[model samples]
Target: KGYGSGGKVTHANVFIGSLAEGTSEATLKDAFSPYGMIKSCYVRNKGDQTYGFCEFNTVSEAEAAIAGMAGKNDWVVKFANNDAWDDEVPHSNVYIGNMTEGTTEASLRATCGTYGTVESCTVKTDTETGKNYGFVKFSTQAAASRAIAALNGNDGWTVKAANNDTGGGGGKGWGGKGGWSDGWVWQPGPSTRNDDSRPEGPPSDNLYVKDLPPGITEDEVFAAFSKVGQVVDCYVLRWDNLSACAALVRMASTEQATRAKSQLSGTIHESCFGPISVKNQEKNGEKLEDHVYVKGIHCTTSEDQLRSIFGKYGTVMWCRILPLPFRAGAGSSSVPDVAALVQFASPEEATTAISAMDGKVATEFGAPMVVRFAEEKANAKRPAPTPNNNLYVKGWPVGFPEFLLQSEFQKCGNVVRLRLLDNPDPEYPTCAALVQMSRVEEATMAVTALHGRPLQVPLPPMRVKFAGKDQGADNSNLYVTSLPRTMTESQIRQSFSKFGEIERLKLLTQQGKPETHALVQLSSPQAAAAAIRELDGSTPAFKG
Candidate 1:
């Protein structure tokens, strides 16, 4: 049981588990010997069954091998300190999961390489069929943090960072993705190959718009712009009584939008009721002073032509042409012709385009295009406060539902207001509540009795002391309680007199027996309250 200090057991004994089916104990020892000295290794086998442990000369040597071997897949390694032996082994790697089928060592290295140097990249695959289930390996803490942040919770994959453990014959391991419930950190993955090319023009800021024709849906709008470029995402905003169709389009570039807007503006789709306009939305709360409105658009203009024409401008973020409703008898439909929203990079560029072509005739499209800044919406009114003084209370434990101040002090006076302070931060509990009384005297009396009771929430609990009473008080009447049973009155009075003038001390007694509670008579009630509140729950022994 006792391996000498220098002969401490090695980590190889605990680190090797579920290794590749035919791996020999000698091979495992050889792999881990580089990390530390391997005194002896034994592989248990019964009719070709391979499972066993290795012993190292020292505990530190074992720990080093354990930490380095974690997250390794080729040789399933699970290492733990021999608790019965009183040795400790620190873990140093984690598991990663939710990888794409196409994920390879090269791709993972490229993705995680930016963080730090990776010790190993092992993808666990089916032993018989060779299908990837997960990956694990060793890396510095900094690199692990970065990998977790970047790969975790990605659109297609999930990345987790945790300690490595060993078990089972299959490569399926626990830790990062499958074991932990906390969602993965977010790190953007590489864009598709098609997305590598730069846009034809400048980039434009995305704009979120509302207030659309009720009948118009996202599909109808996408069809109108499908020819231009790729559409990222589109949705219709729904409210209680109103719905607004919105679309987010990722064009070739900002320049493409300019040409697209010019060509598409004033163009009407057969289904649309009016000309569609386009303008850029501002970012970081910037105001949009200039706008471009396109009118009289031809219904049949293709998205390519639209982009080619408007792309002449500096850049266009996105362009969408509204369509009209279908007509039963007519070959084409034309009913709801509403406005179109366009986003540009800057107001100056938008204004310049508006000035050059506003109300101008379109040679290719035929219909005149009208350009103007869009109107802003009006602000809604807020409701008036309640007539009765209803104090807002927060910051009280939900279980202890009773309002401590309101219930305890309401009987003494007309309770006009009472509430607890609610905190958004979860670490701090609801410690204090507020109470307002009809009469100032009642507030003063409430502050005196329950200022430092055990049941009262401690973080400066709710008290009703007068605002200016402190300035007029002489330091003589402060009450202290919960003193150690061994403490004496003379020692208590002497210890508190330094704060202010302590007139006398009254130690509470039960059946004429001395009690731990004591009330020191300070010069004023305010001083007494202040003293009690300050020193109520401290642990230092009372000194005269």
Candidate 2:
């Protein structure tokens, strides 16, 4: 009879005991499916092994399952803990890993919750190291089961239904051991929350706001919200089809974000023209802002002149002039834009500056500074294929799928991993793929034999080559140049901090070099990949 916290009781869970060593969750679900409506079912794991448990929509369905399965299968199964949903359901947490650099918790919950009700989610982080892992808890066993079935080992992540082990984090266990200890975390707060107060959402530290008037610049928006807390990053998006703009802002902490959203939503700020809607930042279609990208300056425009024209709004961090392509190691090309980037103290300032200067002509250049935000990592240019046992292939048959590719690659050797990417580059976009062979020799062989080979009739020859490696032998250390002269080591470090932990970042000067060079060391290779992939061939303005 003990069903819910107080009154709401919709289902009863069943426990299947003495399961065979190899028994899986699908076997249990099928055994009980014919009896009645199944809510959730899973094989409980002691340590890397599955026992058995399942849930039915009601006591009647559970009874039917118990009566039908008794004396039939070679297993002992019944309601878990004698039908204790409260005791067992809280432990439905799962561990998710292999997230890409810059994966946010809001993104994880939004994606993982598609399978079921996510009761709680904890992203474990190593504060000292800047590495992250995650634990997600679903309300029912079915939710956990569905997620594990669908998301595990997909998208570079390893997903598994957490066990009662110390690492797995049992019923009392929160996030995995030694992780999330005073780390950034989120949890649903008090249920008795009032409507006028901070609104309820999956508790997160970031906030998103929409319906910002065009006239209210990014700096003004930042200044208004800075009243509540320090804004980490703010990106304002304006779609050509939409009349009004929207913004996403990350706060210093979850509590500050929640408080500001509750207080600011439905209220018009002093400089704003309309009521701005404030809520938790969603993972769906979200973008991160580092610096504003600017173009359309006259070739003669100088950084000091541009800064003077734009310095009225806020603190001008640094002004960088985009270098023209050099010719024969002597004179540079006659490019129209020396595109001076006016870096502001914060993204909010950059937002306002772009909103104001994008269409407005520069005072000295006699042309408008085509100010715009840079493309985010996802939308940014894709890296050429990597040279791990992985091979990059393009111009494959249009309709041929991944399984077909895997089958063919197995002929040469074992196909460890294979993926095809949608062409995103505007100039040379096409169907592209990456395949990791079982061994380096196998990769070499596949490249040798498969280069220019035909996969299907009437299609372009399959182009198989080793993906070009990053300019550096390893991306862990990045060599950079053309940085503004005013940028200090701290400024350079701060500019690259979003990618990951910086082990060491410093400036190197050489006698023959036209500009100073910077070398950056990231804690992990993944972080380096993220930096190089997002920033190669692109210029970013850093503030002092």
Candidate 3:
């Protein structure tokens, strides 16, 4: 009624048995589609009868399908054999090798059917050598064992348990190919040999992990290992003869590899496929730390720009932008941002960069950038800072007109200025901006009225808050540098007005000195200090 043997169903695999001859994968998919989302539908043929496994996205979906379709159409539906899901090395599947040119999936099934019920038969050709090899999946381990014994040598083919290299006769079976060839070993099957097995030898930095769940990605494996230690690289290997995948993860050092092996080996991953095997290999991995992951970088931003922006903290060794795997929509091909990883010369530099850049919106990208160690996951969004006359608005739909945002803010108070920006946070596919209201009261009113509500219906709610700092709260006079030669007194006042009301602004020219300096006084000392902090060493490019 519920689940057989295992007590309760924890996975999404649903076994459908006693299928009619004409039933196909599409039929099973249609039957289960109404229940929930299906990840995969597989129909295996055994002579005249057929069976199938339908994998749903959740266990509830599978349970719904089982309950809905159990008695109808004379089909036997239940949770798939938990043993099959729990075991990485399934004994029911046997590997058949050294087959001649005349072999086919049909012939292999026919030959194996004499010993047991052949659930599925697959024959594949080597791309490089053009040699044919095949595998037969039986309903039970005893059937596979019987087929391996009877068909091993009688048909001039090497047959053995897929997980075991030793045939019942003690001959070289599937395990032979798993032996160390040069330095790399084929995965899916367990490795029968390890070159680094010597206890006295130095540990290796590379770890070989096999039996990863099908559909597991390289980035996922990299992330998993990155949590244990620094990951230099991750490679996922897929073989035609194997259902699951394998990975070669290179940690930063032998010590890290050892830690990864100890922590991850035989541990169940989120995929729920099964426990994976992690063993050390002879290859050397890279080194750790000083790597910072920066998210919410504008797509138009480049590695050089990242280097320039982060260079103030310390020396940047390298920077790279990671491409998005897919677009949000078919028509919306342009992405706002791509995340990047920056390598600093030291962990101190990396930490300093993270601390300074984490929630601060870059000048070019008004979106707040999230920074953390490459090995760490992204933290929760920061709380809004103290309120002021300047408001930071984000989450308006991408391509939303700047006039609309200003107009929306104008309802609360006089809109002094609004600057549109590209948001790089993948979670919010929208634009962001810095809005300056004429008064602090108006800015607070705008945030209160529109903080969690959208300007337009059906669009995501816009986030409104005061800019991180009230720049003029601390001082009244600021000595500003890097003013262009053509800049006038009025232009300086206009450029600096966003911080607060300007009391006085003057461009000072000294005899025989090339650099021009501006002395500005704002009504609010906090605003003056904020301006000083924001524009201390930068060239002031006055728009008007």
Candidate 4:
């Protein structure tokens, strides 16, 4: 709804937008509820626009969430209605193209008015040939964003960013998520992404070059800009109120954009607009695709620590580590997933950093971590989970509170359910528990890392295993890799028979060729774990 200057940061609440499908209010509460005594959390949606508003107990808590979520994930988190991101730019400017040959500006405004208020709409005409392409300039960025979404790729019209600071859509603002539009929406230059995947760093190859000598051909634009980077495509575009053609150059990445901007901008052009202004096709005052989203940040980690590690690849635009959000009202004291977003000079630099930093988690309080591409929409991924969300923990220190017991297990993941029975009397002696994690991969990881952990006072090392009722491969099945090339399934069964009963044996092949791997199902988990522990790396020699 018309974003007025009402979202005050001092109020301790922020607006989050573009939530992925399946993201529930509970998920939002679980993720952000820990930031502080969360006052409340709620989500709303219509069509592709889904968003939420959350309030924290303190400004510091809200800031912690903003810093952590800003560049880190798919959800758009911001100081609600603060107008910080909606910078002061031309309010009523837009570029609309792909029109049927005879359409005029008044016709566009009349048509676009059906979607929202249209301040100015026009057809850019060639001064020489009198050719006109469609364009529209709305009253507010919100109205413009809505108009573009409604009008672009519809019938024969296409919309893009306008080229000047004249204003951001000149009419009223829209009421949907993220204020309908931000800098990333459009900027009169190259490679503007109005729709599709979440916007990342700046447009790498999109170059905004203006004041070209009148009637400059695409080849001429390419030849001049190609010195700094490979020019994928170059074309002259006409924007609203502009009589001369402004050239748009597409570079492959930010590195190219920077190089082209530095070398080509400000050059003398014998055109009506005077000397050329070569620069990035930018919105939001930053390149949309040059930023990288990072996760697994430790509480002990600092921004400088991140800069030091990530900067090794290239110039780091910015690196910020946000404190993990915390929720006190809880069933389990589950720790939050800490994260940050680092912007690089270009997308390639970000890709390089990801390759270098992923899985290299050497933090103070936790294990080594891998970085993630900050996604505006949380993608559907299992990461490292199992088929079912459950785990079995076989260790019990009697007298431990159920919450604390859940906390210990929560170190690995969200604990959905826990069942524990203690045996103190001589009549019955057994101490064990079952923990069902919120995700299957979390359960798998818990089983992998905590199966043998000793917590200070030693009663016995914990044994964690999957508790999936019947979802996993049948108990009679085991996945064995690196078998001798010529080994057969029967041979594998014969060799592993030392441990227990083999229900079945089968060799896996690729494209009709037998591979050096086989799937064998034993009678039980104990047998499978034992066989794996004993013979996984043995590599027994065979008479092949």
TM-scores for all candidates: the values are 0.18, 0.24, 0.26, 0.20
Weakest 10 consecutive residues of candidate 3 by summed lDDT: 273-282
Query: Which candidate gets the maximum lDDT versus the true structure?
Result: 3
Summarize candidate 3's per-residue lDDT along 1-544 as a digit string, tens digits.
2221212343567889999988877788888899987655666676887987776655557778988999789999988864232233335668988889978898888878765556668899889888788877665454565567567886578887775422211212221222111111112233323522423223567666654543344545665777788875676664322234467766777788888877876554443311111111112464345777766544334455667877898998887666554211111112223467778898888778777776454554211111111222247443546768998765555444588788789999999889987555332224569999999999989877875452542222211111212222444656555443334454555557678655444444321232344556666656755676665554454421
TM-score of decoy 1 = 0.18
Candidate 4 achieves a global lDDT of: 0.50
Weakest 10 consecutive residues of candidate 4 by summed lDDT: 171-180
How close is each model in CA RMSD to the real structure? 28.5, 27.0, 26.3, 28.5
Q: Which candidate achieves the best TM-score against the true structure?
A: 3
What's the lDDT for residue 422 in model 1? 50
Reference-based TM-score, model 2: 0.24
Indicate the TM-score of model 4. Answer: 0.20
lDDT measured at residue 38 in model 4 versus the true structure, 0 to 100 = 61
- In candidate 1, stretches whose alpha carbon ends up further than 4 angstroms from where it belongs are 1-380, 395-403, 407-412, 415-426, 431-544
The CA lDDT of each predicted structure is 0.42, 0.51, 0.56, 0.50
- List candidate 2 segments past 4 Å from native: 1-11, 45-50, 82-137, 140-544
Better of 1 and 2 by lDDT: 2
Q: Positional deviation of 364 in candidate 3, in angstroms?
A: 50
Q: Report the lDDT tens digits of candidate 2 across residue range 72-126.
A: 7666655555343343222355888767767778888988766555656777776
* True-structure lDDT of candidate 1: 0.42
